[model samples]
Target: MTPHNELRLLPWSGPDGKPCFLLSTDGPLSRLAGLTEAAQLDIAADLLEHAHEVLADESSAPEELRLVPSDLTGALGDALRVAASRGHRLPTPGTSDHGDSNEVPHLPAGAFG
Candidate 1:
């Protein structure tokens, strides 16, 4: 069982769209969450490729362009959620369990406004 502060953030929402979390990291629920997160990431990747194709086409219709943002918005939300969940799991810098000290985290393009 993980400590309260180390709870795993679930990929799906609970009742009424509330955030869900897992206490145990070694169980059926945890496996399911892992699979779900992987699927979400794969879907987001596919959507991104499609978005790029749509955007790069000079003759794309307004209707086609309009739909890309709506789809991208949802994918972005899932990606951000996944990033936050994984970020929380990373060992803090300067901690005993931290990985290579030379590793530096890079922010995504336009991460800061």
Candidate 2:
């Protein structure tokens, strides 16, 4: 019987003991890396980038790589909502609820000054 590789991602850690994110492969992890391993490294690096953002937020957490869906929009939406609720406003996409500032106080990253 042939065994299939299961994708695994490890959170890269900063000096602070929090994971920044990095990609690692072992035994069964190679399959998800794909038919060629070259593409796998690129995907791994991207995962690390995403992990940085995930760690910044107190609400959302980085999940195991295989469990994550290809559709990231919905997952990002939830993260944005959580940030919004905490007074963090996303960059202006266009005219949107500008007048409803009272609904949720939006403080951009550097609004303190």
Candidate 3:
């Protein structure tokens, strides 16, 4: 178990729809975290089929078209965060090294902003 002062990976997003990596000890993850993980996986799985459908339908609503990509991106982002933290390979097989520190470029702090 990680110490209380140490950072722990929470399986959810923060208030602003970003991954919520927070500090934790031996305490269990929040209910919201579990719900968010399940929801993200569900969205990811459904997007596989639904995205095709939306693309094939010419009459697809603008809202539907707009949301699918946004949601899919969010789902993929969450999955990437979890996988990166766990040092696990991504779902799709690729030549990229999932756990190679040398291969992965290290970004400076506050790079996102």
Candidate 4:
């Protein structure tokens, strides 16, 4: 699949039961391993940095920025939570399946009854 399509599946639990997703289009991470925990953490940092770059400037994103995963923060995470609670994953770019153009549900009036 294309990098863009591959990225849609990021933050995915890898086959090894690890929480890393592929990025850089350099190939899968299954091939990379070492005897140190720091080595693995380094890989995770690269992935996170790339994720932020893509989200910040979609145009500057590498054409091959494949298999990237998103770790939502702040507003993005809040939106995702509402979506998950109501049974939906990230909305496709520009899609508004819900009645409003925002598609995201507002925090329930006052957030609790």
On lDDT, the candidate that comes out on top is 1
**Residue 79 of model 4, lDDT score:** 41
Q: Which model is ahead, 2 or 3, in terms of lDDT?
A: 3
Best-to-worst order by TM-score is 1, 3, 4, 2
Q: After superposition, how far is residue 105 of candidate 2 from its true place, in Å?
A: 60
**Over 4 Å off in model 1, which ranges?**
1-5, 94-113
Model 1 lDDT per residue over 24-93, tens place: 8688998888788898899999999999999999999999899999998998888888887777777665
Of candidate 1, the 10-residue stretch with the lowest lDDT total is 93-102
TM per candidate: 0.76, 0.24, 0.48, 0.26
Query: Which residue runs does candidate 4 get wrong by more than 4 Å?
Result: 1-34, 60-66, 70-113
- How would you encode candidate 3's per-residue C-alpha lDDT over 4-81 as one tens digit per residue? 454545676579977566564334564455566677677778886888899899999999999989977877887776
Sorted on lDDT, best first, the list reads 1, 3, 4, 2
What is the alpha-carbon lDDT for the whole of candidate 4? 0.44
**lDDT for each candidate structure:** 0.82, 0.41, 0.65, 0.44
After superposition on all CA atoms, how large is the RMSD of candidate 3? 10.5
lDDT-better candidate, 1 vs 3 = 1
TM-score: which candidate is best? 1
